[model samples]
Target: MAATACGTGSGPGGRADGRTERVTSLTALDYYTDTTEHAHWGELLTGCGEKAGVAVEHRSVPAPSLVPTALRQASAGTLPDLLMLDNPDLQQFARSGVLAPLRAYGVRTDGFGAGILSAGTYRGEVYGLAPTVNTLALFYDKRALAEAGVPVPRTWDELRKAARATTRPGRYGLAVDADASFEATFQFLPFLWSNGGDERRLDDPRAVEALGLWTGLVRDGSVSRSVLTWNQADVHEQFLGGRAAMMVNGPWRIPALDAAEDLDWGVVPLPVPRAGDALVTPLGGEVWTVPRNDSEARRRKAAEVLACLNGPASMLALADWHHTVPSRPDVAGRY
Candidate 1:
């Protein structure tokens, strides 16, 4: 067999072969195409792998085909050695046994962010790791707001009023994406969260209340009706084109916004609902994971790599590169 160094004691060095034993070759996936834009994920994963003293080979599977293909591959005994799994898919895989439980690998409550950890846990078993963290926030055009003599809004009612105040014939107060992709959750979930509603209870009165707020904005002309057909990129385009006064998005868009010289914008936490406490939004991001190895020693080494990646400096650097918040409170403050 072709042997290479596995980071833990179970590999080549632990045996007669002078060559380090190779851990299982890793096949990675991201929900992104546009290789130019997505190569960064490969870089980040590789960087972590290098730091952890292992070679992690990556491959990008189309986001749309990811789940079905993963299921098919698992059935064929050809599942990838590692997966960069999304949060929503985590539970189903865990229940079906497509994912191996991660708790024994040292992904426990203390080290990982609870909010993120909970997203991938089912029936008390953690199934995935998060490499990125996200929260919905307000993106406003500083120049436009200044010109309009409007202040940054701290509450939903104030934001609605601001949206109405800023709207003109060719422009809109707020821009939203209602598409079925994850982006739709980004635009609408925070409003639900701010109002103390949730995705799990879409039939709740609060849920209906939240949806009403969205429809009300469109009804009252604060948001453009055309926005129902838009996507995340569309919202960004409108913001950059100066056709929308404000948008709700995660920090991933910060890099693009930073590069747009003509756009003078600032970010703030999402506004609170009139009926509730301050806004609390859904958390999202990626988690790095090593496939469960057949040998116990390889598993130990994989755990070490996880520890290194979650270290303070690496966490901060990854957070900065990804343009998302760090899970660690200490790491977050350094930004």
Candidate 2:
């Protein structure tokens, strides 16, 4: 699929139920509190609104508060016209009946990655669609790694060796966010999943091996002890401040990485358990969903806005602005 292959309108608009009245504005909700993302998303949404011929009123909350805030809205029967849910929480909202399945509203989903589809699914129904998605990669400071004669690490042993060999008086060779939060699990997934560890079988030997590998890096002083207090953004800071030769981060940090005029960085797939194994990192992004609305006309209008938002041009625009991949595989090639 390609950008040109994306949809152009709400397919076969039979639901213009003649009662659309005069909705001057519709509300939208998301967790993009960062200024860049907030402004960019507002621009994108406003553009989509214009294309759909509706005035879009945007609202946002911190990511941690989204679900609770949504629940409050749900209780008040006042969910936004268009709601953006982080992929993981899509199932929760769908299961709770706050989210209406997109298929019923004619949103496209046939060309997205399976991981993305899985995240937005609830009991076999697609409840949301993200225009773009992101995942972790091993980001190395090119100059630092080259100076230390460390080529990009490709496997567990190689990464360990490179990390240890590159550590110096003030810098650790590698950095990771080992904070005791969901981010820790997200950051650890590549190691565990790349090693064929199963999420369902947490005590499996493969899981233990991955955990042991991380512990080994810490023991050898190749990974900083401060990792316990860090998050993904913190890892980016370590890489930017020259405190770490390499770190695992997502493409969303590309803008931040581009800020330091002297920072020379390169990215590669996260290292695996063995030379031939594929890296398996967690897929991440927010999905757009139409909340259960009071009227058919409102739902139809919201779906039209959604149709525009997920179209190729919008997806590509968003992906480029944020340094993320378009959710539509066809459109993603443009990135």
Candidate 3:
């Protein structure tokens, strides 16, 4: 269904206690912290609402800052009929009873990616829906590596060697975001994983090792000290402009990288530090949910909206439109 297929405004009159009340009005807070996400969400929500017979309103809030406000609002009985949140934030809110359990409403996680599904689950209850996927991985310029006589690094030590070998007077070896935004966590995660560390236990020896590995790059001149001021855009610019040879980024940059006329780049999973060390980075994505309310008709309408958002045809359409992996693995290739 399309936007034109759905009727606009409250039917007959704008009464809050009549048949119009049964027509659910859902609001979605965009968890994506970028302008591109805003545009994509506008399209997706519009199409989904048109198809599902619901009215959707959306607001933008930074991912890190939306949790407390959403929770406070939910507790005050002013909860949005729908919410967009991150996996970690969703889990936290679900555990605190701010989000209603989706199991009773026929929401299922079995259709989503395994990693995304795990992120949405807290104990045995599933409280959120992941409709997009993203993660940080190592990105390298193939030509730079070959010209510099360096191989794509598969381990931390090798990575250091490659960085050292790739550096020149005008170009840096490696670059990463070190700013205060959520992007900093992306820059840090690969290092943490390579050293067997995590944010939950910062005092761990492995954690220190991870931090040291990152600081060591600066000390050894493999990474610039100015990274402390870099954000994701800065790091991206450095790579694209040939001022940096290696960095960590996600699939979202694939289009830009592909369009670069002079750069030759490829992506690989995050590398390890020790011989046996395994690398797993933090995951980031959006979770869409229907809020708790008193009307069964409204709840059903919300369910229909979610179905349209999660449906096979709609998911594939959205994935293609937004350059993202659809929530269902089966339809990912369509993107």
lDDT of 2: 0.82
Candidate 1, residue 1: the lDDT equals 10
Candidate 2 regions exceeding 4 Å error are: 1-20, 110-115
lDDT of each candidate versus the true structure: 0.69, 0.82, 0.73
- Give me candidate 3's TM-score against the actual structure: 0.81
**Model 1 weakest 10-residue run by lDDT:** 1-10
TM-score (C-alpha, index-matched) for candidate 1? 0.79
- Write down the TM-score of every candidate: 0.79, 0.87, 0.81
The digit string of per-residue lDDT tens for model 1 on 1-335 reads: 11122222123224244445545333455555535336665565566566555665556665556678777776775665566666777776677675656668665445566787687678987666665588778899887677778888888788888888888888888888876666687678888877878789999888888888778889999788888778777888888788999987777778788889898899888888774577777777755554553444455555555555556766676677658777766567777
Residues forming the 10-long window of minimal summed lDDT in candidate 3: 1-10
Candidates ranked by lDDT:
2, 3, 1
Candidate order, TM-score descending: 2, 3, 1
The prediction achieving the highest TM-score against the true structure is: 2
- Each model's backbone clash number: 12, 1, 0
- For every candidate in turn, the CA RMSD to the true structure comes to 4.9, 5.2, 4.2
True-vs-predicted CA distance for residue 178, candidate 3, Å: 3.1
Q: Of 1 and 3, which scores higher on TM-score?
A: 3
- On lDDT, the candidate that comes out on top is 2
